[model samples]
Target: MDEHTPLLYPSPESPAEDTNAQCTGVSGVYHRIGLRLVGSLIVDSIPVTLSYILQNSTQTVSILVTGRLGPEELSAAAFSMMLAFVTGWCIALGGGSALDTLGSQSFTGGNRPTDLSIHFQRCVILLWLLFIPVAILWAFIEPVLLAIGEPARLCKDVQAIMRILIFGAPGYIAFESLKKYLQCQGIMRASTIVLILVSPINLVLNIFFVHYTPLGMLGCPVALSITYWLCFILLILVTLLSPTHKANATWGGLQLQAAMNLKSCFGFLKLALPGILMVGTEWAAFEIVALAAGKLGELSLAAQSVIMTTDQIIATIPFSFGVVASTRVGNLLGARSAIGARNAAHASALTSVLVGSAIMTAMLAARNDFGYMFSDDEDVVRLVSQVMPLLASFQIADGLANACGGTLRGQGRQHLGAIFNIIAYYVLALPIGITLAFSTRMHLGLKGLWIGKSICFGSVRRLTHMILGQVIGLFTVGTAEYIVVWLGTNWDKEVEKSVVRNAEEAKRRTLLEQHE
Candidate 1:
């Protein structure tokens, strides 16, 4: 398709053509399609957003509960959780994203009904295996922390927290994997329902264990472990007991033979490895900024922590948009409706921009007071207020990146998305951020760190463009470039690839069954 092609042109087979025919004008037809897709995306995105919000809240509550003990204890809990996110949680989310591509497509591909379940099973097993090393690392993290020159006391505390948290890692990984299993089948609310029921229980457990019980600071991890396992179990029960059996068609009981097939494993990894890097690189970049914040002293660290926490929560909005986009696009591609997939992709990007702008406005409005929710210290609070504008400006670019990234995932181009992230954050964003953050002449401190990040987000205006010039020009361009690339996509080509992918899976299943 070329730039002159209409954004919502109905393919000859599309039912949308009937609706388009009834419209008074071509513009009217496009308008209706835009509204329909945006509305559907919003409806699907809400539950996903809530699920993420509730999921993050469980960990945030743990830190809040432990914060009452002492600063040192709170810091250790936060630090340990950060480590958990970077290692175990990142592996779960990043690796599980493979299913965002495979599971969603398989569910709608029609060629093999069991492909979704088979992919899910393989993902869970692979992620569990991946976590083994992380578990081992957590078990011995104290020495590693000390070797890196962390205070001996803080290292011990972090070690204690991580060791207990380790037992719960598999449950968290499995739960994330299962959520994808259900979501790809259009069961968007199951995980949300599970989290809604479990989040309050998690809060009560944290309060009781940390305060009413004898465990004290250690109780935080105990509660977290129990909560993670409870979420996993509840999700399973929901799947099995749903009146509709929303997942039943795609989930053919455990297929250990197919799941463990050598070629199947390699095929899954082809999509999964880049997915890990696509997500992990961005997460690691932020973690690096957090570490750098520590060097600016306690106040900067505290402010950075609060901003990062708030950003994570806010990030769910765009992330949910991406999730829904990935699923919707995959489903359309699977059904061989290229027009529908392309329209959905464009709608998601447009909706994200609208949602992101609203978020930016809210953040800007609350800039001065938002910091108070996380800290009472005047210095940290002030520093946070000063940094809020940069953070606020980032929401739009962040949303665009996520929406476009989702489209790429749907297209099975995660490797391309991974390349963008590596280039955007590491090669472009970080070096600039770190230099300004640490440079003696600049003395930008926390603000410098965020300035570099804001640039990476490509939110800076002409002033920044003029100041930074070509050295930062590429970094300032942002994820909008992805949208341009997406516009050029051969949607029909993508549909063919999905068909081939499903055909391959069907052939593999046939071979595996014959061998058995």
Candidate 2:
């Protein structure tokens, strides 16, 4: 294969490129680009969405089973699992993205087909080693939570749940590495296939362990651990035994060269650290908002909780679509097709925007009834409906930011993503949101915080630039903040009192639970 060699799937009508070679005039170019974008996104999205749905379903089953045990079990497991996700899975997702650069490039650029296999093992080893500290955190999570003033009973129960889930840490992390390995090979459907097979099995296991077995509440995590291992093992088997994998020769027995090189070790850390921080900063910030929402009145806080829960479900699409972008761009870059890589990145961005649009449309249609799924409180329902437009706006930014971040990861430029996140969220969104949340002069309540967040991404900038034929200008600051400040002028002092009330209630609950 030489520089002039055409893409393997080159368009029949064009010898130059596979994706965008059919254009003649400006209209033709845009038409071809549109077709290519939609084609590739459809190809990538289905498998990714299927896999995530199954995985989330697994979590749902565990929660539902534990919910039957008791409220304490349900809440404890949820809290512990959320923390574990932050500590373990976020790192795994970010860290595994290194392979988005390494494995993809090696697949097309290396002399040996086995390089991807070696790199996969290296990632597995590196991630497992990284999991050590996270595992330690899980072991002593009670003290850490206590030190941070978490409710005493919640702390104790979460610690126990985490200990059970800890058994799955290596498997979960290593499975992430395995998923990347297959993805780099353009084997997008494998994990989806494997998870679909395993998801039902996991539900049965959950029922047996959490409900039928004497393990009860603890059994929920145990079942999850087992499910994680199953996913890992089955993916490995797919790599080894699948007819598609037979041609790759990707699985040469593991090598220790990665372990032997300090440069390589440090290289992995350098790429992975920024990636982790990029994801960690935003997620950690969102966690803070969850904390602050309680400072609003009870009705506001309840509405916030239900809305956030629903948002989590819708959130999966953009993030998963971003994964599709990362994988697609990485593969094209690895093949050294700059044009193809650019096209893939642009297409992915478009796909995210489209997906976000779909979400917004769905939210608009569902707003009246969505809150009723969680609570019957009219205040909560009304507040949630009021915030739907803001939520819809943020969903767009979440999609675009995540998609762009994925592209950066594919290029091995995870640092850029960290910078984007730090500047966009930490330096801007968080402070803006906090100020709006606590603003007595602007009694915007929960809507203020969300408005502050959405404005950071500047939908006005995106729309203005789009209308002006300069999409690049979306990166600039927009007039949304001015709009937010002007609209937020009703001064409500009771929000501050709610903060004090919430703090007192938390302490009382903790003390009372301790006595129980």
Candidates' lDDT values, in order? Answer: 0.81, 0.69
Query: Model 1 reaches what TM-score against the true structure?
Result: 0.90
Stretches of model 2 off by over 4 angstroms after superposition:
1-14, 17-34, 258-260, 455-516
Estimate, for each residue in 1-516, the C-alpha lDDT of model 1 and write its tens digit: 211222222343767655655655325534655665677777788999999999999999999999999999898988888888887798888888888888888887756677888999999999898889989999999999999899999999999999999988999999999998877776788899999999999999999999999889999999999999999999999988765444346778989888877887887788888988888888889889989999999889889988888889899999999888888788778877776777777778778878988988898899898888988888878999999987887787777778888888887888987887787678767888888889989888998888777665553243357136422342245344554646568888999998888888888888878887
Error of 1 at 196 (Å): 1.1
Q: Per model, state how many residue pairs clash.
A: 0, 0
Please tell me which predicted candidate would have the highest lDDT against the true structure.
1
Cα lDDT tens digits, model 2, 13-69, are 344665354544434434545665656665667777777777777777888888888
| Estimated TM-score for each candidate | 0.90, 0.82
